[model samples]
Target: MEDRNNNNNEIYALIIGAGISGIVLARLLAEKNQKVLIIEKRNNIGGNCYDYIDKNGINIHKYGPHIFRTDNGKIWQFLSRFTAWHEYKHKVRAIIEGKEIPIPVNFTSIDTLFDTTKAKVFKEKLISKYGKNEKVPILELKKTDDKDLRELAAFIYEKVFYHYTLKQWDLKPEELAGDALARVPVYTSYYDGYFTEKYQAIPQNGYTKMFENILNHPNIKVQLNTDFKDLKNTKYKYLFYSGPIDEYFNYRLGALPYRSLNFEFKTLPQKQFQSVAVVNYTSKEPFTRITEFKHFFNQKIGQTTVAYEYPAAFELNKNERYYPIPKQENEQLYKKYLQLAEKEKNIYFIGRLGEYKYYSMQSAIAAIFELVKKIAT
Candidate 1:
């Protein structure tokens, strides 16, 4: 690989990926009068959050539903400059035993799905059962010395977590990390809101348009269908990579574990299909969740678009990388890669895949802000 720093006043940074993180970073650099070049492997920009009109002329998220929610005041303000906001609060429901229950398995769901009197008794029993432990792994309940708690936990696991995870990732509960279950918050209140972020909304048009606006500045130039490996020998002052870090290094140590996603998109001849933007199937379904695009966009139409999302193990040739598997083995492998990354000068890794961590869109934007400050200072 050849490294050349641009001494001229033009093209100060070269960014890979064209994802939200890359685009945001490029925008920041452009604002500072630093010329930027953004290269994307895909034909279009916006990375995983990209949306487009499908064959039926319906707006669909090519990857999956990416509802923007954040508590960060700065990120929300920054993104607002790119596009008009659509006031859309996301809600998710889970299909359990042929019954639709509000997701996060809240108090209202427990009452509506079960016999109201029995539900009340069960809630009290559980409170008395667990007692003041705000957060406890449902699996840990199974290993408890008490046989009753074990049976209860087993029931909840089988009915709630087990089949959902299996259908979602094609893995049994035991195959998954314990923290996976812990990441899901079980609420005792009637709050069915999916995210508790202070700010929650989707782009008025779509995420792609927002990105187009972000990268539209004169200082930034975008090259599509270009991979980082193709630009290895090219000269640039600095390289900001947002692709898989392991692939960037040619897996010199070993491949970092990542989860991939398969999206099955379909069109329905109706104004609306699902009750909410997303409906998660907690039972033994082939797909994990089904997302309706119209809900997110708040569009009134005769036809609607939806996607069935399935999470699976990452395969080299197939499957776009989704989540990074945060197991001990993967973390150890990533640490080895991190050591190698430190030695490589003028190359910065940003975004979820580049950092080998699972980050939401809000988090990704936050990371970009931090990275830009570091680079500029």
Candidate 2:
């Protein structure tokens, strides 16, 4: 960790991990006449949203396809200034039992899976049974002492929810949190769009270009392939850390559990492959989903690229951090770290990994804006 103290009158801010949140925070602080230095462990800036051309000359996301979508008008408008809009709306389908059904498992999917008479009867039964309360967890339904409701709940649990959740998280449905299950919204309508957010689209160029624009200011200096541990002895006025909360403190409070993913990208000599952008495999397949790159960017190219995502156990050093497992045990562990974070006055933990919460890209940017506002006031 080489620390060169620049004798500048401006406020010095050190941001760890040049991810979306980190970049946004740096931009906001730099605009306020603060001297900002962004240190990224990876050789690139866009973190999980990073994309580049593969050996086959096909542009692919290093992590996965990240579609920019949010209901916040300010966030949408703000991102627009960096890159032109692609005018793309993402839709995903799940391949379950040899059939491709619209994801979020809507009315059309249910109808397609079952016979017309049985489907109608089942729909009526569900409406009459659960009413307009909206579907909760299978466990919640199982708690009902009523035998028939419990049976129905068990049926849905086994058929619809169990295998898919198991494949996605690599854990049993009962082992997972009710909150995780709650995040999966069940729709009665034929809406097949993956996200229900009002404003949804991707950048025309790429997320990398957008991030480059964000960090292009004079006051912001970027250092890639630099780990936070490398700068342990460095002195800064304040630190904005977007890396794992547990890793920040050397996991003294025990490593906060996280779920990781393994992506396998393949190139083919074809224009198109899948029907949609993303296809979820809900069965017991080793790979959970396959994504076609062209569907995401709507690029007209000769060669095509696709990625097969496989969910795996998150080892300490082997895997790239993806999803944070927010079970009761993990939450208790995070609470200990949260207390530690409060004691550290000079350090501010932001974004999903830092705060140990599942946040959308828009929510992460909104957090930066909030922090900037607080600092200004």
Candidate 3:
């Protein structure tokens, strides 16, 4: 990695990791006439959100399927400036008892899983207790006094939540944070959409292209395949790190727990493999979900690509950190790291691994916007 000449051009901000948070922050600061230098350990710029057109002309998400959905108009508008959207609302299904059912346990799912009379009674009871179109967590629903509703919750827990949670997080639903478990709620209505956000979309070109456009600024300089540790004695006014906060401190304060994923990609000589973009394996399959790439933008190619996601333990220097394990003890450890971080000057920890939080695409961008606001103030 070639070092930048600080005499000719002084870097106003040095950003680690060219992921969504780092790229967005670089763009925001560059717009403010700040000279930004972004270094990424990976050769790619978009990090885990990177996508490319394969031999079949299908846009494949390298890591996994990421459906951009958020209620914030500001985040939507901000991303819209870079690329047009596909206007996609993601849908998911899970195989239960040799049948494909919509996830989040909707009315259709209930109708498919149970007998006609029982399904009708369950739906009516759900609407009466939780109101129509409302989402109820399986854990919360298990506490209901209604025997039928409790039965329904138990069925969902055993068939949908239990085995899948065990495979995804290596823990039960009750072990995770409340908000984490509530992510897949049972809708009271017939809505089968996976996400309920107002705005859900994917970039028209690709996420990599959108990121390329984001970093296409005069004041922003990007260096790929360059590790932060290799850049010794680099000078900058401010440092914005989007990598793991624990790794930055050399693991003196203990390592935070995270869940990693291994993807097995296959190019089948067929038009389509699945009905939807993603399908969860809630039963005996060791892998949690499979994603068909061609379904995302409706690519009209003869061949299709799919990825089977296998969740694994996040071993240091072995695999990529995908999810921060949400536990009370993990949060306490992160707070200790936060205390040490707060003592530093002009250095900010951002993004999922950096802050040790589970953040969606929009949430990550919103966080960068807030960080920009703080810097401006």
Candidate 4:
């Protein structure tokens, strides 16, 4: 745990991870004239959102495809400083019953899936009950007594939600939180984009490039492939941790549950593969979805790269924690860790792993923004 080599750079804070949270904290602190040192366990920055141009000159996400979308103008503005934006609205399709349909079960999906009379009946019924341009939750849709509506909900549950949820979380639909499933909005129109956020785009360059720009400040120094445990004895004015909350405490109270994913990337000698960027296989397949990377930024290349995602149990040493398991048991365990974290005087826990919550890219930055505000005052 040696101090940073530069004598001129007096470090004020030490950040455990170089992911978005840690980078955001470092940048915010550096702006306030506080020198920061970031320690990253990985070889590079951007965390799971990392992407690079492949051997075939096609941009590919190493983990999985990430299409940045956020409604927050502040986050958009902050990120804009690092990388120019590529205006790309992402659309995803689900392969169910051998038919590719738009997800969120839109009006177009209903028309494509059912017979003319039946589809019309459904469209009329849905609009009449929920009103036009409304996003009705699947849970609310399932609770209806109407035979057509219940059948529609049941179809969505079985074809869209059931097998996919089972494959993704290793849990049945009932075992998970209602909000997790309820969060899937059923669109009443032909809008095909995955998100309804005001601002949605990918970086003109890759995420790694953007991260490199973010950490390129004079007051900030990054040490890659350095774990937090390596610097346990080192001291600073404050410590910002973005790793697992339970792991920080050495799991004395037991490890918090999380879901992990295994990605299989393939480089094929074809120009195109799937119709869209992402194709969800909502069936009893071992892999949940396959993503064609070129479709994301509309890369013009002869060969394309695709990734197959398989969800698995989060083994401590085997796989990375992709998602915090959203259930009562896990929440209770996280709260215990939170309570422990609260007693510490100068340590701040940020990001998905530290907070033990599922957060989007924007939400993670927003978390850091809130923490920065609190620390500044």
All candidates' lDDT scores?
Answer: 0.80, 0.80, 0.92, 0.87
Please list the residue runs of candidate 3 whose C-alpha ends up more than 4 Å from where it truly belongs after superposition. 1-8
Local error of candidate 1 at residue 317 (angstroms): 2.0
Candidate 1 ranges beyond 4 A from true positions: 1-10, 55-57, 125-153, 174-179
Model 2 Cα displacement at 311 (Å)?
Answer: 1.0
Worst 10 residues of 2 by lDDT: 1-10
Candidate achieving the largest lDDT: 3
Q: Pick the candidate with the highest TM-score.
A: 3
Write candidate 4's Cα lDDT for 1-377 as tens digits.
Answer: 22334455456799989878888788888777778999999998877788888788778888788888988999999999999988988888998788889987899899889999999999899988888888888878999988999999899888898899899988898899748886677887778888889998989988889988988898888999888887766657788999999999999899999899999998888889999999999898899999998887787778888999999999999999999998998899889999999999888888998899888889899998998888776
Q: List the residue pairs that clash in candidate 3.
A: none
Model 2: lDDT to the true structure: 0.80
Clashing pairs in 4: none
lDDT of 1 by residue, 168-223 (tens): 65667777753776666556466778777788988887899999999999888999
Q: Considering TM-score, which of the candidate structures 1 and 3 is the better prediction for this target?
A: 3
Name the candidate, 2 or 3, with the larger lDDT value. 3
Per-residue lDDT of 1-377 in model 3, one digit per residue for the tens?
02233345778899999999999999998888778999999989998899998887889999899889999999989999999999898899999999999988899999999999999999999999999999998889999999999999999999999999999999888899749988889999889999999999999999999999999999899999999989988888888999999999998799999999999999999998999999999987989999998888988878989999999999998998999998899999999999999999888999987899988899999999998887786
User: What C-alpha lDDT does candidate 4 achieve relative to the native structure?
Assistant: 0.87
Q: Where is model 4 more than 4 Å wrong at Cα?
A: 1-9
Candidate 3 lDDT at 24 equals 96
